[model samples]
Target: MAGYVCPVGSSSPHARSNACPPGTFSNHLHLFDKSQCETCPARFVCTRGTGGKQKPPVPCPVGHYCPPGTKYPAQYKCAPGTWSNRTSLASEEECLPCPAGWFCVAGAHVPSGRCSPGHYCPDGTRTSTQFPCPAGTYSTRLGNGRVEDCIACPVGSYCTDGTSKPTLCPVGTYRKEQGAKVSEDCVPCPGGYHCPELGTVAPQACGAGRFSDPGSASCLSCLVGHYCADEITSREAMLLAMVCPAGLLCPEGQAVAPDANGNACPRGYYCPRGDIVRGSVWLLLFTILSSSGLCFWEARVESVLLLESLPALGCLIFLLWFP
Candidate 1:
């Protein structure tokens, strides 16, 4: 009788008190049962009261749901990474995180679906947009959960766009630097160097007696009358070696002839061999002369008298024989 309250229309001392209905409470002490009870508002909970007093309605706690007519606090709880839009949610299923390729903030009712191609999103993200992968990195998959999901571009390779894989440098090209972002980042191999394979980091120098054109895959042998003794780096140097010097004969693969001295065979000299220095010819000449001389006086006088005495003796002998 002490905890009970009488009705408004019945003033009798023996009148019985009526209990408050569910979702509503009455807190008037020593009041009549006809007193108007307060109903719990949305997202609030109320329970039956005793001793002619009613419990005040309380707001719903976070992660816990309360319906419009909730009478108790032990209703429901939202799942992790999920949130409720408004109070008085009936079930935990109403709370949902952002979908794939999207981002959602805490307690967000709608997801931000404008994630960029080079970025990633995780559940329950509070930011309006996704995070971008760092330079020299890529994210091929969509809706990546963390920054670690981005991969690094390999050495000697390039990645131009976001969310793409590494591409190998083409032949005749090289990339010594790291983290190339485009195909043009690959440099052309210098002239007289060889770049035979893909993803070359450095160009190889041409071998001895071999030359290469600019951005060539392989080195070619020097042509006749041309030579490349060392790593020729330019076309001008190769062309200078290719020309044959005057008065000198050059064969294949030779830069200079051994017998290329500037001197030639002398005049009236025959040189049959190609080498004039080693071959020469000489000619012979003959001369004839006529002269007359007289004997000395002593010998010449004796010889003249002998010739006259012989003629006189011959005449005398001829006369004596005639007498």
Candidate 2:
């Protein structure tokens, strides 16, 4: 017999014969030697080999794989990122890959858990923390599986790597774009305004006679006449600006009100606006009145006056410009 035991059973007429046991296998033809049958190796199992090749067993099981044969009834575990829910698994292929948005450990039967917030875990990942939201990005939800799940930093704010919240842009700065990765992305506020608080999307307008250069830290008071009337862009809206009306000590950023008359013009000079200064008109008028012998130009002029029409004052004052 190829695999059967000495079926003749000691060659006695009364002796009985039987098939080979489940654990042993024999592969010879016409072999009656009892020693020919061999014990099965660990890598394979032998059973019901009456006269020829051994029968193949069913798949080992679902969860546990074939053991190294170190002992009986023992099983091996699946690798990381792969899992099995039952016992006696046949091969490594029997294990399932980790699902999306989740992770599996080396011996996990099901996914260990969902990916955490601010982190990501793609299908087949071995750990929950395999990836983190990168710099300039953030996430607030769990079970995120890809880099795309992380959102870009928002306008008027900044975000660091793996951040979950955005930080507001500081005062004196502003951001206009949808995604501002770092604090440096916040730009300086434009000129003529001031930023007064912690976060500023738009700067506050400076007070009249006050100005800020590109949202500087503080507002600077304007000196009267120091700012050119024709200049634009660099100038603040003079919404409440006041000009010294006539005959009072009024400087640029006047904080006090005019109360009474001040200095008057001398014969050779004239007072206009708030200054005592002489121009071509004063010289021309003085010569004309002196030659006419009228000398009527002399009057009890009290203070510098801003008049709509100075000629109405009867030569007491001469205005070169009305605008």
Candidate 3:
């Protein structure tokens, strides 16, 4: 006889709201209501049971599993910290750590990928292995891409990773302070001093009376007859007042005296002033005195002859003036 189906949850015949259709509830239909069903506890799938259930036994979906505890409606999830390449029909294994120099950002789900070049993480975020240090710079310490690893200037020179050593001024040059890592820091020779070569040493002075010019190898002497007053004070000043004053002839008799400028004439020489005639006369007397007796005798004969030759010569002789 035709009959009504059964209702959920009631064990009595009243639970059937209607008679089962030929195909309906033919499989394991253990639970009267679909709502009462649950997925297997995490690694097991549903299987046919004694009762006629809404669905036949089924396997878990790919990448996922149905655990043992429940039967139908719900699906189970993978265990925490565990993963599988494809859907899992069984329990999952724990994920492994990424290899060195690599990172696994998504934990169990994603694969490890290479770290970016110029950057490294030996132990994930805990340590770093930065790229190579630049030329002229070094990092004996760890380089985590931070500023601390960069080198700095030493006592006498400076830099900001711009160059290796604090630039050494060439041999004959100097810098005021440290951190000068370039040629620009090398200063020129000091006043009155000179340095043909460039470098870190203080400029040498063209000592007293010497003239030191820039770019020259050594100091030069002041011209003759000129004095180098305050010679040591300034070399360029050597040119000043270097000439002898006019009228103050650098006398021939005496070595030319280096005026107030420090000029020194040879000894036995005197620079006299006024008419050269008087000077000539004095020079003549000196010449005569220095001559031999024969020269004196000859000079005497000439004078006597001239006196006899003229009447005026007689007048001049009485005046004690004989030419």
Candidate 4:
């Protein structure tokens, strides 16, 4: 036949050249039936041959796939991010990427699954090993199809695992450093400062003479009868209480004192209540002077003065008689 070739190793002259078999082909015309035909190998095909020559199998080209026993060029192409290697790949399923944590090079006979914890692999990767996710990025899943799978750490969160999602920084804590990988990377708000919410980059300082508890949202004024020293931290403010001097008067919510040392009673003044009021001092002085017979002049002075004066007048009369 014009388009047929004899099979290889056939000894009979009557054996006519025939069309190539599904898995085999010959390029030479008038070839002895005894001539050996070429067999298609995996991932390869032998679709065309001349009448007088043997044809070599052609490698399956890119964008097309050839299964074992294929006598013609493949009509199917590999799926995106997938590849096949070697001849005789029977199906598209045979063309696969290295499993999670591993990588497979082009034409690889076996997949590599040896990637370390911090590394990852994408589909159709040709390297024998995986590449690391870049800083500030992470991947928690295995067998990532591409670098795009690596996720960026959120503004308030941290990520460590190459194949995992990021974690949020806790309340009262902050992380200024980029690409923080763990909660430990977050710093606690300092004393006298407040970190009200999560992911704070810096703590907010309490206002002057004001204090806040740790992680407080707002600062508190010093309590009544209490004084907050300047620049005092929250912890110190809580323990501080203002005390008035022994002799001075102190009222609630007194911030500045006209005389912090206290108002002292004058030397001549007797402050019975420890206060310098004029009424108490006068009342005390009057009571003391009137009780004694020291007042000699006015009847309004007292009973004691009357008794003593009468006795003195009688004595004077007796003295006059004796004279």
> TM-scores of the models, in the given order?
0.42, 0.48, 0.33, 0.40
1-323 per-residue lDDT for model 3 (tens digits): 11223355455532333333321222333334433434333444553331233434444554345445434423444333233344335543423333445444432344334444334334332223233324334334422334334454443343433242344555445555544555556565554566655444556666655555554445566433333434342434544544345323332212233453443322333333222222112111111232232222111221111111211211111112333
lDDT of each: 0.55, 0.56, 0.38, 0.51
User: How well does candidate 3 score on lDDT at residue 280?
Assistant: 19
Model 3 score (lDDT): 0.38
Tell me the spans in candidate 3 whose CA falls farther than 4 Å from its real position.
Answer: 1-161, 196-198, 215-217, 223-226, 229-235, 241-323
Candidate 4, run of 10 with poorest lDDT: 314-323
Of the candidates shown, which would achieve the greatest TM-score relative to the real structure? 2
Q: Alpha-carbon error at 12 in model 4, in Å? A: 21
Tens-digit lDDT string for candidate 2 (129-169):
77878877888888888889999877777777766778888
**How would you encode candidate 1's per-residue C-alpha lDDT over 1-323 as one tens digit per residue?**
22334566655533434555556655555556534655656676665442232336666665457666566665555553566656656556667765545665444445644455566666655443446666666766756766677677676788754545568889998888777878888888787798899999888998666777887888776654344556653455666644433333333444332243632323432223222221122211111112222221111110111111111111111111111
What is the total number of backbone clashes in candidate 1?
1
lDDT over C-alpha atoms for residue 246 of model 1: 34
- Candidate 2 pairs with clashing backbones: 61-88, 63-86, 64-89, 224-252
Q: Higher TM-score: candidate 2 or 3?
A: 2
In model 3, which range of ten residues has the least summed lDDT? 302-311
| Candidate 1 Cα lDDT to native | 0.55
Itemize residue pairs with steric clashes in candidate 1: 27-54
Candidate 4 lands at a TM-score of 0.40
